[model samples]
Target chain A: MKPHWLVRPGSIRLLWIVFLCILALTVLAGLLVHPHAAFGIDGSFGFYTWFGFASCIALIIVAKLLALLLKRKDTYYDGD
Target chain B: MTAISLIPPGLPLVLGALLLPLCTARLRALLVLGLPLLVLALVWQLPAGAVLSIDFLGHELAPLSDSKLARLFATVFAIMAFAGGLFGLNHMRVAELSAAMISAGSAIGIAFAGDLVTLLVFWEALALASTLLVWSTRTPQSRDAGLRYLVLHLFGGVLLLAGIIGQVAATGSVAFTAMALDSPAQWLILAGFLINAGAPPLSAWLPDAYPEASPGGMVALSAFTTKAAVFVLLTGFPGADILIAFGLYMVFYGIVYALLENDMRRILAYSIINQVGFMIVGIGIGTEMALNGAAAHAFTHIIYKALLLMSAGSVLYMTGKRKCTDLGGLFQSMPLTAICGIIGALAISSFPLTSGFISKSMISQSAADQHLTFVWFMLVAASAGVFLHAGIKFPWFVFFQKDSGLRPPDPPLNMRLGMILFAFLCIALGAWPAPLYNLLPYPVDYAPYTYAHVISMLQLLLFSGLAFFIMLPYLKRTLTITLDWDWFYRRLLPRAACPLVRALDAWQRRCSIDTLRHISHFLGALFLYHGPQGVLARTWATGSMVLWVVILLGIYLLAYYF
Candidate 1:
């Protein structure tokens, strides 16, 4: 039997394959569930889905940027 | 006359608090506990519709009643006071304990208030007492937080007073009744109530101030203010449409910020906003089932939130640390607290056998029945988020993360006992919801334990758990403040005001120095010019007068000739 690749440093290339697998799984699940019946493309359903996903990504990006700017040493509150 | 005492039930707690400073620390603590117990006994003995009336400042006030809604809130408040007193016994500062008692009693007064005047009075009293609790910490940060808290609450009080005056002017009645949203007066009252509920734009105040309080102080602070506001909204503005949107926003705001928060106590504080969001949504739906859900949720939430805060308070007490980064593997030493905290976490997440599931499900059911499929879906997603942020993230990060190797002993016996009592209540209520439902303003017809419902909830929450572990890299803790609506005051206003204040100070200093220099120079010149032997000062008063008169006479003669 072949060993699972994630256990070894030599298998770093497997990480991308894992990522793609998850993405494909998500898309397949979406198609199978047929969320279009509940959320049509033309209506607010699409907007909310896109907006929610976009905002989540944007928030993560903004959080990272703010962390760079405003991050403090853990002992900052201790002095006061 | 078979007459019930007309004095307000909450008055003795206030009076006792005033006298508490005179007592020894031991006696003061006893009185703090005893006063609320006595009030609870009084509340129980009073018959339904028992009325109390008094006139103060030309306003008639009545704060006695024993209606189901009043009984429900009052009962829990008394319980909270007792539990809070037990928890606070070791840290017995007379001022804080007394203030907490007064805060609890005032909430009780609002619960039993028969008129708007009485309710408004007690509402303001709640503000004063709770602010005193914050200020009693005697730290600069706590003082600042307390001041900001006072400003927000006082503004809310003014809105309430204005609304009451308008209602009195319009209807010529001071009696408290369910208000329709059509009138401006009623809408004002709703705004006032919503403000205290920690509704949006201003909702940041709860998380901002509460986490800044002393460890014991947060336990007391958790129980009263927001729940009292929920009680008022339930009574006053039952079916407002705007509340639905506000609730949804608060729910998301709580999750987003809680997800970003690093401080353990602050995370719990944000979770309070999230849980209250459910109640507010229930209140907005305003069906029998929804109101019942709200009332029951309030009962359950108070216990679980207090339990959560108590656990966090214990951790703070033991380690003197509050941030998630500073705490981990604490459960190894404090196993009991960890277990109790996890109980609270599960209950809050509405796991099938916990209080939240039985109570919060009704609200969502009502939304679905109302054909609010989108709202229901959003709430379902939020439920998943709740598990991600609070239900699991809290305990996992604080108790089971990469071990920080800091183990403090279990908290004091009284604190443990308090946590146990509340934990027991959480489980008991979840197992047997009938008692809670019977106390609701409406009948409970909806069932919470359905096979499909349980399965879906588990799938959603469990998957969210999977997401949390998977996304742990993104969820790493950092030492930075997440700016909220509070940035309007904490950062923006202060930053904006500093320059203006500096300019004003500079201008004032310059003006003062310039004015002093000019005055001194003028005084010196006057001394030089008018002294003997100086330029205009000689012994010539009489000569000058004669010259002036002669000049005037010559001018008059010339004018007459012309």
Candidate 2:
């Protein structure tokens, strides 16, 4: 059997590079864009930004926790 | 508030659903198909702003009303009901169809409602109707999913009712009117509307429950609940700021989850959230253009989403499989369904020549004019994302993936015909959006097919396509389930209940044992005391009887003296 791709040396290096590039680009774009244009003026605040980010994180965590308990076998609904 | 009721003359359509199950199967099918057309005719003839009010529990209910907005939504709803009934007639259980018709009628009732009370009543009827659709699948998973779906919607309905009561108390007005979200009551009402829009935290419920429903049931389910919420939001809380943030989250949330999903139907369900996200954002912006965009998007989205679901349902019906892993190369045999599905995909992605392109662009244009740069950029990114996951991923995996060796023929002619009609509308609306725009609550000036906009969108989507293909290895299907908020009740609550149940069982066992011991001790004491010739037992029955009679006689003597 072929080895898992992620564990391969070249694949790992490529993954990291891609991750870093995406992160750098996102930050650079945010800095370059006018803050008002990037975020709406009416409701944009440091609080909301943090709140939005935190809410997303919380949702992911909650979903993961729920999956542990509620997930059934793939055939849970299937007829034989 | 004017007392002119907007209730339609076709109120009996609701009652007719109850009579459907009693008819023979063939007649029942005809009734299901024909009733909506009849109602549509009646709705067409009704005078605008016509009122049909009645008293119930001391509150007046205006279950029907006619306004431009109400008429537009109601007309489409009636059309959807007819199409849905036609599509469902072949495969849906008779009882399920009856339930769906009642649900559809209630949604129409909601669209025509002139008062909060009436809207709420119809709102809850929608929930019940939708839940029955989920339950009709007759699987344990569907049963559980249906129960969870009911709970969320009921919670939303309760929130709405509370908000309405608060509004009534504050303003002494039950008329449904657009208001700023200032007071707790108004805010509650907004929350209620947001929940139905599949807003964040609670948003996962839409994706969770919908894909589990019966094939045709899902098509019916997709058109009603969220759109009703959109109707309420557009009417009641147009300028709310919180909605923008919620909408943005939903837009990306849909793309992300859909990207990860393996099931064709679930991917479409997630995409529904994404598409509705655009409308929700429009509602939040509350400009004439934005509101018009929201309204128009609702109309087009309903058609395309239903069409997409129908196409997916056709596949599921023919092959009895839903996962992309199990489906591939179906286009060879199911060419008609595949073509219809691709048209829906293009429309959803807002390709220049599709319904989505015409309707969704107006809101983005509204944002651009407002100088809200971030909102504009995000919307653009979401548009690209829409193409990435749904536009390409859906048709690609289902129709073009390495052949899975299944060549199920196209679904029945009726299903194909329904899809073709919807597909034609999708293209026609894109080509000439005037008719749809004319129907909007506001005038439309935006053109969707500018050279710059079209080219940029194509570039963005094309690059995203490249990315999808490049990273196809990461997009493998897995057997593991992706959890959503329903996990709280489906997993967490049940798991939490298990330990509680065990503890209660142990406590009950100990209590029973203790009670048994105590009773045995009491009996032993009595038997020991009552043993042959022992103490009180040795005293004769005659002596006891004489003592009792003496006591009675003494009481009688005292009474006589008094």
Candidate 3:
């Protein structure tokens, strides 16, 4: 049986392209819609776009660092 | 406050729990579907203000209060029970279903409780019933996890009880009113509520036990306990200030641990703590807006969180697999489940048009309104991170990632129906917030959908999604778990006990054996000297006794002369 079109390699690349377009469109939206921030710096251009991206990157990095000490086999407690 | 006789909304569910096991499957299904709707109707029928008052301990205690906050909480709990009953109608054991009703019923009881003592009693009942729900799974893992859950809750209960005693002694009243953090009793009360809220140093219990429950059992487990804690905190000690710190920690802690989690269910479990943290923070803020946000968030959260769990539960129900490593590409077989799961995910992420969008923003909007710049920043980051972790990661791993060569269809009819009901609710509340807004404890003045608010939220969440794809390599789950606070008790305490137990065993043996030997040796010498056959005991002892008496008489005379 043929694989589902959603999962096939060619469609996968197209999905990525679509996702990127949406990402760009959100940033471009900053021109028409300015996010009113209570804080002074938060209202600057594309603040949420960059902040959201940076926040996730930071979360992943910090989580990875902590994983060094905290990570154990999923069966970590089964021994007890 | 009127004194008209009204049966409490939750009482029938508790009674129904007993009746369920005695009936046929068809009858049981009817009661499960009918009882919670009955409770929901009864809940709304309650008029605002103190409705049922009683004399207790030389004070007027309102055992039933239909305050707006109480009614709001009671309404959600009833919905949770109804949906959960539907979800579990087929898959869950009779014991689990019965226990779930008891748990849900008591949660309703707490919501309507008017005095501190009444709330505490209902809380304890909630704890015991919840423990029974976990134990009903009858797995070794769930049994031990249930024991840990019970111990922690009992510990929390003790703190609450002591707090109530001290409070009563200090104030001479039991009204469950808002308290300032001016007394040790208030602090104890806060600790008790926070512990159940999955606060720090004791937070590990939620993720440790909840995921261990059977699939449907977990859906029921997710709705109460912590949400009830939020209900109490909203009413009992709003604006405590310190909760802000605890809440922030939980939000980040949940995100990071979930990032590292492999088991699909534990990720959801950790996210429960993460989600409740937002409500706690709002309670700390304690503006009318903030409190409304917290209460509203709790209301919406129960629906979406349960929806997420229902979809996840469906996957587990069909596949009999829970680990991320063991699941993937199930969207092929379970399209409806996947779509419903995505809807739940979107709602939980607080995307532009969902129940979460309207409710969660109120908390952040309150923070921003107060110019709590730091809190506002953290909440924004956490909101984005919520999208990163739960909104994307849960569905991404369970349904859409690399194919694992397993094909399982969607769950049974009841489970599908359950998911659809909550899914509809998520969109309905988001699209039309007036019904939920109207039920808020405070008058609703805030509008959630502004062009600016919607735009910022979209950028934040969409970028978070982009980051997820970019960080895919790092976010790939390993076959591992992150260590948490429960390690102190579940692992460390038990491990630490081995040597102490051994030492105590040795000490007990010495007390019974070696110490007894020493006492027996002394007794043996005394017996040897005093025996009837010994020299002093013989007939000659009479002569010796007389000689000693004469000597004593002589010594006494000499002393007198001196």
Candidate 4:
């Protein structure tokens, strides 16, 4: 018996390639559309792309830091 | 008046719940499925005004009314009841089905309540019913969690009651309408509504209690309370500026905490606050479009979030595992569940041609329309964060992470049917949003599928997806929980009480000791004056008594003569 193709490492690599291409196309699409901006600097090219990426990165960083202070065993409240 | 015309919109469902516990399994199933559909039909058929009103407490009380907005919320609530009933039809506990019906009915009642008193009555009913739903799980954690959930909701209810009293006193009106925020009454009302909406500082109650429910119960618990709060806020305090800040805090709080969470259900719970945050912000924005967006998002969010939870619940039902660390690669055996979960994930992420895209974009568009530059950007970023935490993270970790070797099949037919129903709705409402748009309180003026909008939203979301995978190492789940504001009552308050209790014990002991000494001193004085060896207690007592009487008589005679 063989494993499913989608979960295979080779197929996973190919899927990654396809996904990256789609990402590139979306950025290209961003370049193509002239969004009617209502705010300063949001009208710039690939603004949502960069801002979305940057915001998520910042969110993960802050969360990781907060975890250092706040994280506890899943049983934290169980004993109480 | 007909039976329904005399009673409120959701009374039948609540009444039907009473029959559930008494009925046979066949009758119970019938009541579960039939009651909500009956309510749904009745909701749409009602005329748009108060059909039931009476004089109560010297004011007109409209317990049942109909309007486009009310119909919108009631329609979704009824649909949710039907779907939840279908999913939980075989739930081990009959009590849960009963509580679900009551809460679902009260939510519809809230949608139609035209006066503060009527709303308050149904609101408290919702709190108790929801608490029952939590307790129905019959686990120790659920017992304690239900207590916390009940306490917070009761506090919210008290605030709401006090505010209603003050508002009625000050204005002598009970109409449930938009209110100014100038008075303390309005602030109290806003606080109560905010607490239920899962706004920050008090928002910890949501994730802490929600994930403690049964798989079936969680699906039912997810829809009513918070959305009803959004409904009230949408009706009661639109255009309140503070909600914008509250909404934004919930938005990010959900993301960061969910990103740190390991339990799959808890992730969805945190994201509930996040999803509701978007609606709260729209309500805060308070334009016609934004109000519509908030309402539409509530409608769409209920379905999709239910869909997500249904699938998650299905997995839990089959495998008895909920943590991402313990779940993975079940897509191998449960492809239907995986596909449905992914659809829900996409809908929640507002992927183009999904329900979220149509409904949530309107909220962001409204912010842009108002030229709220900072808000607009934050909403855009939060939209992306929605993708990170709920959209990709949930599906990736649960379905595609390293295989946990669980081979549970998709849940039974009823659960699948429930999930499919909502999944179809998520796409149907998005692919053709006209039906949903027509139900909004305001006229639809925005197009969701414009080329630029789709492209930019895709750019934002795809990049967010990229960011997620890039940061996947940090997002990995562990057997740890992140503390939130509930930590105050859950850990700190209990720990802080120990010392306070000891100090009070010491104070009471010292006081008792001092009182004992004082009693001994008083006893010694009594002994000195009147004990056996004392002069007054000896044989001279009679003689002294006679002498004193003689002296008293002589004094009286002398005074009289004078």
List candidate 3 segments past 4 Å from native.
B1-5, B506-522, B532-562
Q: Second chain TM-score per prediction?
A: 0.92, 0.89, 0.95, 0.93
Name the regions of candidate 2 deviating beyond 4 angstroms: A1-80, B1-10, B502-562
lDDT of 1 at B244: 85
Stretches > 4 Å off in candidate 4: B1-6, B499-562
- Tens-digit lDDT track for model 3 on B1-562? 2333356777889899988889999999998889999998888766656467778778776667788988899999999999999999998888788889988898998888889888888899899988988887788999999999999999999999999989999999898989998999999999999999999989988988898888899999999999999999999989889988989999999999889999898899989999999999999998999999999999999999999999999999899899999999999999999999999999999997899999999999999999999999999999999999999999999998899988988888999999999999999999999999999999989999988888889999999999999999988878898888888887889789989999999889878769989788887787787778665566775788899999999999999988
> Ten-residue segment with the worst summed lDDT in candidate 4 chain A?
A31-40
Instruction: Report the lDDT of model 4 for residue B112.
Output: 93
lDDT of 1 by residue, B1-562 (tens): 3354555668788888889889987787688778878888877777667877777667676767557888889888888888888888887477888888888889989998888988988999999988988888788888888899999999889998899889988988888878888888888888889888889888877987888777778888888999999898888878777888888888777777787789999999998998888889988888888888888888889889899889999999899899998898788789889989999999998988889889888888788777677777677667777887788889988987767878699999988988999999889998888888887887778777755555445555555665666677888987756766776777678779999999999889878869788788888889798767776777768888899899999999999988
- As a whole number from 0 to 100, the lDDT of residue B412 in candidate 3 is 89
Among all candidates shown, the one with the greatest DockQ: 4
Which one wins on TM-score? Answer: 3
**Per-candidate TM-score, chain A:** 0.49, 0.49, 0.90, 0.91
State residue B553's C-alpha deviation in candidate 1, in Å: 3.8
Give residue A42's lDDT in candidate 3 (0 to 100).
Answer: 87
Which residue pairs collide in model 4, if any? none
Q: What interface RMSD do all candidates show, one decimal each?
A: 6.6, 9.2, 1.1, 0.9
Alpha carbon deviation, residue B2, candidate 1 (Å): 4.5
Against the reference, the lDDT scores of all candidates come to: 0.80, 0.79, 0.91, 0.91
Off by over 4 Å in 1: A1-80, B1-7, B23-32, B499-550
Candidate 3 Cα RMSD after full superposition onto the native fold (Å): 2.3
